[model samples]
Target: MSSKIQVLVQPGTIIIIQNNNYKVRLNMIYGKVRVLRNSHRAFKCIPWLLILFASTSTYAAFTDSLTVGNAKALGLGHAVTADPPGIDSIHFNPAGLTRLKGRQMHIKGVYGLFETNYDLGGYGEYQQGLIDELLEYQYPGSNGVIPPEAEAYFYDEALNSKSSVEGPTVMLPGGMIDIPFAGGVMGGASYSPPGSNMTFATNVYAPMMSGYNRAEDDPGRFFQERGAFTLLTYFSPSVGIEISDELQVGFALNFSYAGMGLELPAREPHLLLWQYGHPWFQDNFCNDDGTPTGTPDLNLCHIVSPYISYGDLRIEADQALVMSYNFGLLWSPEPWITFGLSYNSAVKNDLDGDWEFPIDPFFNQVLLDNMNGSLWPSFQALTGALGLPLPGVAETEAQGKGGKVNVQYELPQHASAGISIQITPKWKYNFDVKWTEWSVFSDIQINFDRDIAFLMLGSIADKLLYRGQNGIEPNGVRYQLNLQDVTYWGMGTEYQYNDKLAFRLGYENRPSAVPSETPNAFIPINDGILYSVGIAYEFESENTLDFSIGYMNSKSHYPPCSADLGNGCNPNNVAYGPYQGQDLRSEVSFLLFEVLYSRYF
Candidate 1:
């Protein structure tokens, strides 16, 4: 009789199978199992194996803790209204620049350290054929479960994984030479890190199969790491005119440059058993007499060699240059009251660069020869699955890799309004509202030559549709984007005890650019309360120094994860996951230190 039997076992039950020539053993829990024998081999049925073995996890979303405004002045919650001092005043209220008592030159420098600790984990089933077919369609030139690409795309999607820990010690040493001419002229330059550092890790594991639960103390695994960095510098020149003692007007030209680099270390292990149709079994076949079987089944046996590769992809763009202009007005309506307004034009950046993706000479010769051509569409689709829009492509065009992709980024226009009042000789109050048109950042595009391999992936056509829907006209054969917008509200207070010492405090709340419904790990929507404190000391001379610190305790209440069916018969009765029930907390702290030196000319 055929040795086919289905049995339901309770959790923690050890089942033993025996045949005339063979024996097998397994631990079963809360499920039905089927055992079958054909010729001399046996197979067991474990339906939810993928769900049991898969890993589900979470990580912090990507959010910049560093605000673009002056880090020093920002530390005080921007409450420096009653007494506007130096060039740093442009950050708080450009109108405040009118309060400069004399022609002066000011220079300032800053340094900072940032860190984050992340703890995340989860379990989810793998849809065997779906992911494979999707990958094959997306990356046509790749073969048999491209583990590197798989892990890259998986983590990119699951983790929306960007770096949480960005250690940046930046210098904003700009010397503003202010002159009292028609109005006034001030020019200076500053340097800072534009975005969070990019650090990533990829892990892959083989699927479990019959007889060989492959369930040893530890299963096989592979890991890879990649790191990227960027530096940004800006130059500004401005002119202000004093219309009256109480009102002043000013204008400034803005220019900036950005540089970026990336490094990736790729590694993978060859598996002897995984290549063959039977993966979970031991490699060496032995006879009952404990002797090696000279004639091994070559069809069911193979060898995998350890392989490592490093790829350095570098791109430099002189086109990283950006330029804009700002206008400002300040008014002192009464002895105790002052108001300021500033408008900053958008800075447009069309970054053109030479890009080189150099493959490793040792282990990637095959990839080098075969992987030439356009892979952007596949890369875009992979990134899309992770909820991040690719750099220069629209959501629709993301599926097609063929087109002119240009690397571009834009800084939006901004409007600021602020008011300061001296309620008492020792106490001052301030309020400011700023609007940033971040929505103008719509999309980034990368232009590339049309390679047939890339064209076959439907990259160009998808992008064309996306452009049409967005009402974007293709320029120089490239696509466009429409990013989200942002608004900020701020309030601050200053208490003075003496001529040399003062205490400052402030608060700011900004809404998230991305809505909670489409929360992606790539860009986190951070809406939080910022608390700040700072101390300013003035020397007997014409110089001063300031120190400040701030903290942000943020929380996001995301909808629960999908329900687990095992605990209930119907969808409504399904067991809900832990992360699904409530809020996820994320915390960030900013320690800012700066020194400013001023001298009248």
Candidate 2:
């Protein structure tokens, strides 16, 4: 019997015993105790979780809705579909720009302020407790009696989570040069600042069961940390020509540069298992018998443990480049009526960057040892195959250091139409509608060069599974995002109180693109209604100064939560209060000031 056992163990057994004691201990202590408790708990609550996740994930919101050029439209509630003569007229109606009368140059600057508050409450906590009780039942308490405190800890860790307020300022600066030539020929170049903003906040929490621990109960804990920040910018230079007195055509070359920076503090919880906590816990918590846990505290300090590495994790993306083109047409057969159409081609982005990680040395060793001596080389090989830089170094240095190809992103196309009508000389009105084809923004593909790393990371197997789960195509591409065509309706009227001064009032209604099934932290979908009023002053010459102020109001409706869950703050669970499915309102007010100095050459 001894000889037979020795033969079965072999050299591999010895290595496994020596290098990975945690797995050995786990197997020895609870191997036969059933590891499916966590899975079971997940299954029990999936229906409700799916419902909430789906509803929130479906809609996409506009962090910044104001277009790049044209103060007139900006001031007129973005309702300048028909009112013309500013550099941004190309965005509304290129024909209006053609009627500029003479060669001119315009410069404008705008300061924007944004504020948002979220009110969320739900049943995530109660579900967490149920999962804990299940886990405790399957595993059995060490003392034969389950402690009520343990159950409370589980609930505390599962729900009662809050996020800090995040407000970022946006800057928009633009300039346009217009040239008027023979036969109504007007050519020009326009430059608008790329849309850019940053969001940063810190969260602190009390002790609770960690999603990483899978522990039925744990003492109070604390976690303090910061979130993510990203910046995006775009540049477009265009030229327009008039074919006849009533017909005008235009084309634009668009260029864009995007950069992202992510700095997550070191003291946050480590969702990975083995060294400290398990990765599964990051999204879930369970009991000894594998029951679902309720709302768990997500405060940063409460989640961290002494056994884990507390090193800051930073991911700074390299500058990504994309190019596209725009075409537009304007026709005015009658003096009082004008029509326009425009299309923007899809933009493809080839992103390459590194993810900087100062991971725990011990865990790194554990992972390396498991790889059978080929981790680093395999990682390098995969990076080369994907045209991506290593995950930490700058783009240039990453090319030299070598890494694996991780992911990719693509932009969508857009189409728009506008109409302007003159009702008497003093009163005029305009309308505009636009659509973006965002469904084409399908998948984010991650490629691996090394067979071992690829397999261990579940790149090949999990990729297939992920695709299937998200309705991805055969090429490992998933189009789970259900973004719909966007619609915008605007109406504005101008009252010319004599030729020197004019007052404008406009209103706009813009629908969100996000569907109702997959809401997440990134997209805040709210149908926005805008009210605007502006006054334009023209001096003796062709110079003008336009000042406009606008206000926007929006609201979102969510589901209900369970009674056991504290407040319905859990985005994953249902709401219990009378406010379930009721609207969560948000408000925004803006001020637009523009000075347009036009010089006829």
Task: Choose the strongest candidate by lDDT.
Answer: 2
| Tens-digit lDDT track of model 2 for 1-601 | 0010000112111111111111111010000000000000011111121111111111112422352424577556565444445555544444345555433444444333333333433333433343444445544663434366444323333133333223221111110111111001011222222221111111000000000011112211111121211122223445556677677766655544432222322221111211123224533564444333553222111222322432333333333345666677778889898787876676565544444435445433334333333344576478557543222212212222333333344555767777878889998787877776656543434332222221223223223333324322111222244455666677777888998999988788876655544432223235667777778888887677776666665555443332211123332332111112212222323333433344332
What TM-score, computed on C-alpha atoms, does each candidate reach?
0.55, 0.58
Supply candidate 2's per-residue lDDT for 108.
43
The global Cα lDDT (0 to 1) of model 2 is: 0.37
lDDT of 1 by residue, 56-102 (tens): 11011112223332434555565443344356444434445554543
lDDT values for all models? 0.37, 0.37
**Residue 216 displacement in candidate 1 (angstroms):** 28
Identify the runs in model 2 with alpha carbons over 4 angstroms from their true place.
Answer: 1-69, 81-85, 120-128, 131-162, 169-235, 263-314, 318-321, 357-407, 446-480, 560-601
